[model samples]
Target: MKIAIIGTGNVGSALAQRFVQSGHQVSFGVRDASSPKSQKASTIAGTTLLSIEEASKLAEVIIIATPPEAVLSLVAQLGDVKNKIIIDTTNSIRTRPEPYATAYHALKEITKSNKIVKCFNSTGFENMNNPIYSDFGGIDMFCAGDNKEAKALAQNLAKQIGFSECWDFGGDDKVELLEKFALSWINLAIMQGHGRNLAFKVIKRA
Candidate 1:
Protein backbone atom coordinates (compact mmCIF):
# COMPACT_ATOMS: atom_id res chain seq x y z
CA MET A 1 0.00 0.00 0.00
CA LYS A 2 1.22 3.47 -0.78
CA ILE A 3 0.56 5.50 2.36
CA ALA A 4 1.04 9.26 2.63
CA ILE A 5 1.23 10.60 6.16
CA ILE A 6 0.50 14.32 6.54
CA GLY A 7 2.16 15.92 9.51
CA THR A 8 5.60 14.77 10.64
CA GLY A 9 4.73 14.85 14.33
CA ASN A 10 4.98 11.93 16.73
CA VAL A 11 1.85 10.11 15.58
CA GLY A 12 2.72 10.56 11.93
CA SER A 13 6.34 9.49 12.38
CA ALA A 14 5.42 6.47 14.47
CA LEU A 15 2.83 5.25 11.97
CA ALA A 16 5.24 5.89 9.10
CA GLN A 17 7.88 3.67 10.67
CA ARG A 18 5.44 0.89 11.49
CA PHE A 19 3.83 0.97 8.05
CA VAL A 20 7.26 0.85 6.38
CA GLN A 21 8.27 -2.06 8.59
CA SER A 22 5.05 -3.77 7.55
CA GLY A 23 6.17 -3.69 3.89
CA HIS A 24 4.17 -0.71 2.76
CA GLN A 25 5.42 2.29 0.83
CA VAL A 26 5.38 5.26 3.24
CA SER A 27 5.83 8.93 2.49
CA PHE A 28 5.81 12.04 4.60
CA GLY A 29 3.70 14.91 3.26
CA VAL A 30 4.73 18.26 4.61
CA ARG A 31 4.53 21.94 3.77
CA ASP A 32 8.30 22.13 4.10
CA ALA A 33 10.25 18.98 3.27
CA SER A 34 13.34 20.45 4.87
CA SER A 35 11.68 21.17 8.20
CA PRO A 36 13.26 19.48 11.22
CA LYS A 37 10.28 17.22 11.79
CA SER A 38 10.13 16.16 8.15
CA GLN A 39 13.90 15.56 8.08
CA LYS A 40 13.69 13.43 11.20
CA ALA A 41 10.88 11.35 9.71
CA SER A 42 12.85 10.95 6.47
CA THR A 43 15.57 9.26 8.53
CA ILE A 44 13.32 6.24 8.80
CA ALA A 45 14.11 3.53 6.29
CA GLY A 46 11.83 2.89 3.33
CA THR A 47 10.18 6.29 3.54
CA THR A 48 10.15 9.27 1.19
CA LEU A 49 9.49 12.98 1.74
CA LEU A 50 7.42 15.19 -0.54
CA SER A 51 5.17 18.21 -0.57
CA ILE A 52 1.62 17.62 0.68
CA GLU A 53 0.12 17.85 -2.80
CA GLU A 54 2.70 15.55 -4.36
CA ALA A 55 2.43 12.92 -1.66
CA SER A 56 -1.36 12.94 -1.61
CA LYS A 57 -1.53 12.64 -5.35
CA LEU A 58 0.73 9.59 -5.26
CA ALA A 59 -0.84 7.71 -2.36
CA GLU A 60 -3.59 5.12 -2.12
CA VAL A 61 -4.12 5.89 1.54
CA ILE A 62 -3.70 9.33 3.07
CA ILE A 63 -3.43 9.58 6.86
CA ILE A 64 -4.09 12.96 8.39
CA ALA A 65 -2.14 13.15 11.63
CA THR A 66 -2.06 16.91 11.78
CA PRO A 67 -3.77 19.20 14.27
CA PRO A 68 -7.52 19.15 13.71
CA GLU A 69 -7.70 22.84 12.90
CA ALA A 70 -5.20 22.50 10.06
CA VAL A 71 -7.55 20.39 8.00
CA LEU A 72 -9.38 23.48 6.68
CA SER A 73 -6.31 24.71 4.79
CA LEU A 74 -4.97 21.23 4.12
CA VAL A 75 -7.92 20.22 1.95
CA ALA A 76 -6.75 22.58 -0.79
CA GLN A 77 -3.28 21.03 -0.82
CA LEU A 78 -4.52 17.44 -0.73
CA GLY A 79 -5.10 17.42 -4.50
CA ASP A 80 -7.91 15.16 -5.68
CA VAL A 81 -8.61 12.67 -2.88
CA LYS A 82 -12.02 11.52 -4.06
CA ASN A 83 -10.69 8.12 -5.01
CA LYS A 84 -8.34 7.57 -2.06
CA ILE A 85 -8.83 6.26 1.43
CA ILE A 86 -8.43 9.07 3.97
CA ILE A 87 -7.75 8.12 7.57
CA ASP A 88 -8.40 10.82 10.13
CA THR A 89 -6.05 10.25 13.02
CA THR A 90 -6.61 13.62 14.64
CA ASN A 91 -8.70 14.44 17.72
CA SER A 92 -10.60 17.66 18.24
CA ILE A 93 -9.81 17.87 21.91
CA ARG A 94 -7.89 21.13 22.09
CA THR A 95 -9.08 22.48 18.73
CA ARG A 96 -11.06 21.50 15.67
CA PRO A 97 -11.68 22.58 12.10
CA GLU A 98 -14.42 25.12 12.79
CA PRO A 99 -17.79 24.47 11.13
CA TYR A 100 -16.90 20.79 11.37
CA ALA A 101 -16.79 18.86 14.61
CA THR A 102 -13.79 16.70 13.69
CA ALA A 103 -11.23 16.27 10.98
CA TYR A 104 -13.18 13.32 9.64
CA HIS A 105 -16.19 15.52 9.07
CA ALA A 106 -14.10 18.22 7.50
CA LEU A 107 -12.49 15.84 5.03
CA LYS A 108 -15.75 14.22 4.10
CA GLU A 109 -17.50 17.54 3.44
CA ILE A 110 -14.68 19.41 1.75
CA THR A 111 -13.33 16.60 -0.37
CA LYS A 112 -16.82 15.19 -0.97
CA SER A 113 -15.37 11.72 -0.63
CA ASN A 114 -16.98 8.75 1.03
CA LYS A 115 -13.67 6.93 1.44
CA ILE A 116 -12.89 8.48 4.81
CA VAL A 117 -12.47 6.80 8.18
CA LYS A 118 -11.79 8.05 11.67
CA CYS A 119 -9.01 5.94 13.17
CA PHE A 120 -5.80 5.84 15.23
CA ASN A 121 -7.10 8.81 17.20
CA SER A 122 -7.93 6.96 20.39
CA THR A 123 -4.47 6.37 21.87
CA GLY A 124 -1.11 7.92 22.50
CA PHE A 125 1.59 7.87 19.84
CA GLU A 126 3.67 5.49 21.98
CA ASN A 127 0.99 2.86 21.59
CA MET A 128 0.95 3.35 17.84
CA ASN A 129 4.77 3.01 17.75
CA ASN A 130 4.52 -0.32 19.55
CA PRO A 131 1.08 -1.76 20.25
CA ILE A 132 2.43 -4.95 21.82
CA TYR A 133 2.19 -5.69 25.52
CA SER A 134 4.26 -8.53 26.98
CA ASP A 135 1.38 -10.40 28.56
CA PHE A 136 -1.54 -9.55 26.27
CA GLY A 137 0.13 -9.20 22.88
CA GLY A 138 -1.16 -6.47 20.52
CA ILE A 139 -3.61 -3.91 21.85
CA ASP A 140 -6.84 -3.00 20.07
CA MET A 141 -7.61 -0.20 17.59
CA PHE A 142 -10.94 1.27 16.47
CA CYS A 143 -12.40 2.90 13.38
CA ALA A 144 -15.68 4.51 12.33
CA GLY A 145 -16.91 5.47 8.85
CA ASP A 146 -19.78 5.15 6.44
CA ASN A 147 -17.65 3.66 3.71
CA LYS A 148 -17.23 -0.07 4.18
CA GLU A 149 -14.13 -0.26 1.99
CA ALA A 150 -12.42 2.54 3.87
CA LYS A 151 -13.22 0.95 7.23
CA ALA A 152 -11.90 -2.43 6.13
CA LEU A 153 -8.67 -0.91 4.87
CA ALA A 154 -8.24 1.03 8.10
CA GLN A 155 -8.75 -2.14 10.13
CA ASN A 156 -6.32 -4.07 7.98
CA LEU A 157 -3.70 -1.35 8.29
CA ALA A 158 -4.19 -1.33 12.05
CA LYS A 159 -3.52 -5.06 12.28
CA GLN A 160 -0.52 -4.76 9.97
CA ILE A 161 0.94 -2.29 12.45
CA GLY A 162 0.61 -4.75 15.40
CA PHE A 163 -2.88 -3.97 16.73
CA SER A 164 -4.62 -7.17 17.69
CA GLU A 165 -7.96 -6.00 16.30
CA CYS A 166 -9.53 -2.90 14.90
CA TRP A 167 -13.13 -2.85 16.08
CA ASP A 168 -15.81 -1.12 14.04
CA PHE A 169 -17.25 1.72 16.06
CA GLY A 170 -20.25 2.13 13.74
CA GLY A 171 -20.68 4.53 10.81
CA ASP A 172 -20.48 8.25 10.05
CA ASP A 173 -22.90 9.31 12.76
CA LYS A 174 -20.70 7.60 15.29
CA VAL A 175 -17.56 9.54 14.38
CA GLU A 176 -18.06 12.11 17.11
CA LEU A 177 -18.61 9.30 19.58
CA LEU A 178 -15.33 7.74 18.50
CA GLU A 179 -13.57 11.03 19.12
CA LYS A 180 -15.10 11.09 22.59
CA PHE A 181 -13.78 7.60 23.09
CA ALA A 182 -10.34 9.00 22.35
CA LEU A 183 -10.91 11.62 24.97
CA SER A 184 -11.64 8.85 27.42
CA TRP A 185 -8.17 7.45 26.83
CA ILE A 186 -6.67 10.90 27.19
CA ASN A 187 -8.48 11.39 30.45
CA LEU A 188 -7.29 8.09 31.86
CA ALA A 189 -3.73 8.23 30.63
CA ILE A 190 -2.95 11.91 31.04
CA MET A 191 -5.46 13.69 33.22
CA GLN A 192 -5.88 10.82 35.64
CA GLY A 193 -2.18 10.03 35.78
CA HIS A 194 -2.46 6.42 34.56
CA GLY A 195 0.62 6.96 32.34
CA ARG A 196 1.18 6.77 28.58
CA ASN A 197 2.20 3.10 28.42
CA LEU A 198 -1.37 2.00 29.13
CA ALA A 199 -3.54 0.79 26.24
CA PHE A 200 -7.06 -0.56 25.63
CA LYS A 201 -7.91 -4.05 24.50
CA VAL A 202 -11.22 -5.90 24.13
CA ILE A 203 -11.69 -9.40 25.50
CA LYS A 204 -14.48 -11.75 24.48
CA ARG A 205 -16.00 -14.42 26.64
CA ALA A 206 -17.32 -17.42 24.83
Candidate 2:
Protein backbone atom coordinates (compact mmCIF):
# COMPACT_ATOMS: atom_id res chain seq x y z
CA MET A 1 0.00 0.00 0.00
CA LYS A 2 1.32 3.42 -0.90
CA ILE A 3 0.31 5.78 1.88
CA ALA A 4 1.02 9.50 2.08
CA ILE A 5 0.75 11.45 5.32
CA ILE A 6 0.21 15.18 4.73
CA GLY A 7 1.53 16.51 8.00
CA THR A 8 4.85 15.74 9.69
CA GLY A 9 3.73 16.58 13.19
CA ASN A 10 3.33 14.20 16.12
CA VAL A 11 0.24 12.49 14.70
CA GLY A 12 1.57 12.43 11.18
CA SER A 13 5.01 11.13 12.08
CA ALA A 14 3.68 8.55 14.47
CA LEU A 15 1.21 7.24 11.89
CA ALA A 16 3.88 7.19 9.20
CA GLN A 17 6.17 5.07 11.31
CA ARG A 18 3.43 2.59 12.15
CA PHE A 19 2.37 2.26 8.52
CA VAL A 20 5.95 1.78 7.38
CA GLN A 21 6.54 -0.91 9.97
CA SER A 22 3.39 -2.60 8.73
CA GLY A 23 5.09 -3.03 5.32
CA HIS A 24 3.52 -0.12 3.53
CA GLN A 25 5.33 2.38 1.36
CA VAL A 26 4.92 5.61 3.32
CA SER A 27 5.59 9.17 2.15
CA PHE A 28 5.47 12.26 4.32
CA GLY A 29 4.75 15.81 3.16
CA VAL A 30 5.49 18.97 5.12
CA ARG A 31 5.86 22.74 4.73
CA ASP A 32 9.60 22.32 5.01
CA ALA A 33 10.12 19.02 3.24
CA SER A 34 13.83 19.28 3.99
CA SER A 35 13.53 20.18 7.68
CA PRO A 36 15.31 18.01 10.21
CA LYS A 37 12.18 16.31 11.52
CA SER A 38 10.86 15.66 8.05
CA GLN A 39 14.20 14.42 6.77
CA LYS A 40 14.91 12.43 9.89
CA ALA A 41 11.46 10.84 9.90
CA SER A 42 11.76 9.86 6.24
CA THR A 43 15.31 8.55 6.60
CA ILE A 44 14.96 6.68 9.86
CA ALA A 45 11.82 4.98 8.71
CA GLY A 46 13.07 4.57 5.13
CA THR A 47 10.06 6.38 3.71
CA THR A 48 9.89 9.20 1.18
CA LEU A 49 9.57 12.93 1.85
CA LEU A 50 7.73 14.54 -1.04
CA SER A 51 5.79 17.62 -2.11
CA ILE A 52 2.01 17.49 -1.68
CA GLU A 53 1.51 16.99 -5.37
CA GLU A 54 4.05 14.21 -5.59
CA ALA A 55 2.84 12.47 -2.51
CA SER A 56 -0.83 12.69 -3.39
CA LYS A 57 -0.16 11.34 -6.85
CA LEU A 58 1.74 8.29 -5.64
CA ALA A 59 -0.56 7.33 -2.81
CA GLU A 60 -3.52 4.98 -3.06
CA VAL A 61 -4.65 6.03 0.42
CA ILE A 62 -4.12 9.51 1.87
CA ILE A 63 -4.06 10.03 5.64
CA ILE A 64 -4.50 13.71 6.48
CA ALA A 65 -2.91 14.73 9.76
CA THR A 66 -2.78 18.48 9.14
CA PRO A 67 -4.44 20.98 11.50
CA PRO A 68 -8.07 21.96 11.02
CA GLU A 69 -7.22 25.31 9.42
CA ALA A 70 -4.92 23.66 6.93
CA VAL A 71 -7.29 20.82 5.90
CA LEU A 72 -9.27 22.88 3.39
CA SER A 73 -6.15 24.24 1.78
CA LEU A 74 -4.61 20.80 1.63
CA VAL A 75 -7.69 19.29 0.03
CA ALA A 76 -7.93 22.09 -2.51
CA GLN A 77 -4.39 21.42 -3.60
CA LEU A 78 -5.03 17.68 -3.82
CA GLY A 79 -7.38 18.00 -6.80
CA ASP A 80 -9.04 14.87 -8.26
CA VAL A 81 -8.76 12.49 -5.35
CA LYS A 82 -12.30 11.58 -6.36
CA ASN A 83 -12.09 7.83 -5.95
CA LYS A 84 -9.33 7.83 -3.32
CA ILE A 85 -9.89 7.33 0.39
CA ILE A 86 -8.92 10.24 2.67
CA ILE A 87 -8.64 9.58 6.39
CA ASP A 88 -8.95 12.88 8.31
CA THR A 89 -7.20 13.08 11.68
CA THR A 90 -7.75 16.73 12.56
CA ASN A 91 -9.47 18.37 15.55
CA SER A 92 -11.15 21.77 15.54
CA ILE A 93 -9.68 23.11 18.76
CA ARG A 94 -10.03 26.76 19.80
CA THR A 95 -7.50 28.75 21.81
CA ARG A 96 -9.55 28.73 25.00
CA PRO A 97 -8.15 27.38 28.27
CA GLU A 98 -9.93 24.03 28.18
CA PRO A 99 -10.07 23.59 24.44
CA TYR A 100 -12.46 21.24 22.66
CA ALA A 101 -12.37 20.14 19.04
CA THR A 102 -15.25 21.41 16.91
CA ALA A 103 -16.52 19.35 13.99
CA TYR A 104 -19.64 21.08 12.65
CA HIS A 105 -17.71 23.24 10.19
CA ALA A 106 -15.31 20.45 9.31
CA LEU A 107 -18.13 18.02 8.64
CA LYS A 108 -19.70 20.56 6.30
CA GLU A 109 -16.53 20.65 4.23
CA ILE A 110 -16.32 16.84 4.19
CA THR A 111 -19.95 16.25 3.18
CA LYS A 112 -19.09 17.68 -0.23
CA SER A 113 -16.49 15.05 -0.93
CA ASN A 114 -17.18 11.39 -1.54
CA LYS A 115 -13.57 10.45 -0.91
CA ILE A 116 -13.30 11.54 2.70
CA VAL A 117 -13.62 9.62 5.98
CA LYS A 118 -13.61 11.12 9.50
CA CYS A 119 -11.49 9.03 11.75
CA PHE A 120 -8.38 8.80 13.98
CA ASN A 121 -9.38 12.14 15.51
CA SER A 122 -10.76 10.91 18.79
CA THR A 123 -7.77 9.05 20.23
CA GLY A 124 -4.33 10.26 21.20
CA PHE A 125 -1.24 9.45 19.15
CA GLU A 126 -0.15 6.84 21.67
CA ASN A 127 -3.25 4.78 20.96
CA MET A 128 -3.11 5.55 17.27
CA ASN A 129 0.25 3.85 16.93
CA ASN A 130 -0.06 1.05 19.43
CA PRO A 131 -3.57 0.31 20.63
CA ILE A 132 -4.24 -2.54 23.06
CA TYR A 133 -7.92 -2.39 23.78
CA SER A 134 -8.51 -5.88 25.26
CA ASP A 135 -6.42 -8.65 26.75
CA PHE A 136 -7.58 -10.81 23.87
CA GLY A 137 -5.67 -8.51 21.47
CA GLY A 138 -5.64 -5.03 19.95
CA ILE A 139 -8.56 -3.60 18.11
CA ASP A 140 -8.49 -1.66 14.87
CA MET A 141 -9.48 2.02 15.02
CA PHE A 142 -12.94 3.38 14.26
CA CYS A 143 -13.84 5.24 11.06
CA ALA A 144 -16.91 6.75 9.39
CA GLY A 145 -17.36 7.78 5.79
CA ASP A 146 -20.34 8.60 3.62
CA ASN A 147 -19.10 6.16 1.03
CA LYS A 148 -19.29 2.55 2.13
CA GLU A 149 -16.46 1.47 -0.10
CA ALA A 150 -14.24 4.21 1.26
CA LYS A 151 -14.92 3.13 4.80
CA ALA A 152 -14.04 -0.45 3.91
CA LEU A 153 -10.77 0.68 2.41
CA ALA A 154 -9.89 2.57 5.57
CA GLN A 155 -10.70 -0.53 7.60
CA ASN A 156 -8.31 -2.61 5.51
CA LEU A 157 -5.57 -0.05 6.10
CA ALA A 158 -6.20 -0.23 9.83
CA LYS A 159 -5.83 -3.98 9.78
CA GLN A 160 -2.49 -3.72 8.05
CA ILE A 161 -1.26 -1.74 11.03
CA GLY A 162 -2.08 -4.58 13.47
CA PHE A 163 -5.63 -3.42 14.16
CA SER A 164 -8.20 -6.23 14.05
CA GLU A 165 -11.29 -4.32 15.14
CA CYS A 166 -12.86 -1.56 13.08
CA TRP A 167 -15.99 0.23 14.16
CA ASP A 168 -18.23 1.85 11.58
CA PHE A 169 -19.95 4.86 13.14
CA GLY A 170 -22.33 5.21 10.17
CA GLY A 171 -22.19 8.05 7.61
CA ASP A 172 -19.61 10.79 7.38
CA ASP A 173 -22.19 13.20 8.75
CA LYS A 174 -21.88 11.37 12.05
CA VAL A 175 -18.27 12.54 12.15
CA GLU A 176 -19.21 15.48 14.37
CA LEU A 177 -20.50 13.12 17.00
CA LEU A 178 -17.17 11.32 17.09
CA GLU A 179 -15.28 14.58 17.51
CA LYS A 180 -17.57 15.53 20.36
CA PHE A 181 -16.76 12.18 21.96
CA ALA A 182 -13.13 13.27 22.02
CA LEU A 183 -14.03 16.34 24.09
CA SER A 184 -15.70 14.13 26.68
CA TRP A 185 -12.56 12.04 26.86
CA ILE A 186 -10.47 15.16 27.37
CA ASN A 187 -12.60 16.40 30.24
CA LEU A 188 -12.33 13.00 31.91
CA ALA A 189 -8.59 13.03 31.47
CA ILE A 190 -8.32 16.45 33.10
CA MET A 191 -10.36 15.33 36.08
CA GLN A 192 -8.82 11.90 36.58
CA GLY A 193 -5.32 12.49 35.19
CA HIS A 194 -5.74 9.28 33.19
CA GLY A 195 -3.26 9.88 30.44
CA ARG A 196 -3.92 7.62 27.43
CA ASN A 197 -4.44 4.31 29.19
CA LEU A 198 -8.15 4.22 28.52
CA ALA A 199 -10.16 3.20 25.43
CA PHE A 200 -13.80 2.86 24.48
CA LYS A 201 -15.34 -0.55 24.06
CA VAL A 202 -18.70 -1.18 22.41
CA ILE A 203 -20.34 -4.43 23.45
CA LYS A 204 -23.42 -6.03 21.98
CA ARG A 205 -25.43 -8.34 24.22
CA ALA A 206 -26.91 -11.36 22.64
Q: What TM-score goes with each of the models?
A: 0.98, 0.84
Q: Can you write out model 2's per-residue Cα lDDT over 1-206, one digit (the tens) per residue?
A: 88888888778887887888888888886667777777667664668888887888888878888767676556556656765667887766542112223332453354355667777776678777786666847654777768787788877777677666778887856776776776666666655688766666566799
Residue clash pairs of candidate 1: none
By summed lDDT, which 10 consecutive residues of candidate 1 come out lowest? 33-42
Cα lDDT of candidate 1 equals 0.94
Off by over 4 Å in 1: none
Residue-level lDDT tens digits of model 1 in 92-115: 999989989988998999999999
**Candidate 2 overall lDDT versus native:** 0.71
182: Cα error in model 1, Å = 0.8
Candidate 2 pairs with clashing backbones? 140-165
Runs of candidate 2 exceeding 4 Å displacement: 95-112, 133-136
lDDT, candidate 1, residue 57? 93
Leading candidate by TM-score: 1
